[model samples]
Target: MKVVNENLPEEKPRHLLGIGEPEDIVEGVRLGCDTFDCVAPTRIGRTGTIYIHRNGKLEKTSLRKPEYQRDFSRLDEGCDCAVCEKYTKAYVCHLVRSGEILGGHLCSIHNLYTIVNFTNKLRDEILHS
Candidate 1:
């Protein structure tokens, strides 16, 4: 991590790489990381992947299955992001099923939003802490 941070521009915001889990993001923020990116969400989404949150526990959906063909729901109901607001699970699932480029893009957008937004929130938390 030190080596990677050393290579970044001193004037630029410091970000931690390969962050995935929500808790990991929080830790990175505590460590002064201002940015983070991960491929898990999209990589998994392209395969009919879904994410479920229940009792504060995260459940990842696996793509390589036929069940998502008709399941319709927001990827994360708690998420008010564009993808969750304007899209449906069934549609995204279909896009993935049909090998549509939009599917991955949409998923990537959401995933990016989730990470970036979470990081921002973490920053806010740190400022107040």
Candidate 2:
């Protein structure tokens, strides 16, 4: 990707497909890619997994985990997404454990918001630098 990025003209935007992981997004940006699209975010969301930013790092979190069963905190602190605004970790965990479809919906909402916000931040940082 680095080599291809170097060879491409600056006017040509690089768009990476099926590369949606946090690390991959950052790396792709570093390699001069301008855009990305992938199903990994929604794919994981379907399984009750979501993404969160912590200590300046991005990580995956599963609502079905034991710890979340009693965790009454928001899915992601400081997130304004609808799911995070109204749902508790315990509630989401319970929903998933109980085999409810809402569990995945909430996770998807939070995960997609995280990913979009992450990429936007990355772009701002790159532009300012």
Candidate 3:
């Protein structure tokens, strides 16, 4: 698996396989991987949890719990997707707690869009090189 990534042409678009670590994401970009995705993000989100980086420290918030019952906030401040723009964390948490499938679907869709946009930005960066 590593051999394939090591052998990928720098000028041709290639995807890094099975990258789940934050450090690996940096390495993959350095290796010229224009696209990358993982099931971890959505898998975590669907469980009423969220990943956050605060002061360089990673934190996971469990939204399914009663603590976030009235806490309304965006899923991600940097995310430009419709879900992030309009929906609140509290609402999503409610959906998940109520077993509403839309919660998972919305989270998955926004997650995919974020990944797609990130990859496109990387592709642009590669093209400019």
Candidate topping lDDT: 2
Ranked candidates (TM-score, high to low): 2, 3, 1
lDDT of 2 at 86: 95
Per-residue alpha-carbon lDDT of model 1 for 52-82, expressed as tens digits?
Answer: 5556655565533567667677867767788
Clashes of each: 1, 0, 0
What TM-score against the true fold does each predicted structure earn?
0.68, 0.95, 0.68
Per-residue lDDT of 64-110 in model 2, one digit per residue for the tens? 89999999999888688999999999999999889899898889888
lDDT comparison, 1 vs 2, better candidate: 2
Q: Each prediction's Cα lDDT score?
A: 0.69, 0.89, 0.69
Please give the distance, in angstroms, between residue 64's alpha carbon in candidate 2 and its true position after superposition: 0.8
- Residue 60 lDDT in model 2? 88
Taking the tens digit of each residue's C-alpha lDDT, what string does model 3 give over 1-129?
456767867587776666644556657887656566677668866766655445644445676878667878787666778888889878988898998988877676666665566556666877798
Return the TM-score for candidate 3, rounded to 2 decimals: 0.68
Candidate 3 regions exceeding 4 Å error are 1-12, 20-23, 51-60, 121-129
For candidate 1, the clash count comes to: 1
Worst 10 residues of 1 by lDDT: 56-65
Total clashes, candidate 2?
0
Clashing pairs in 3: none
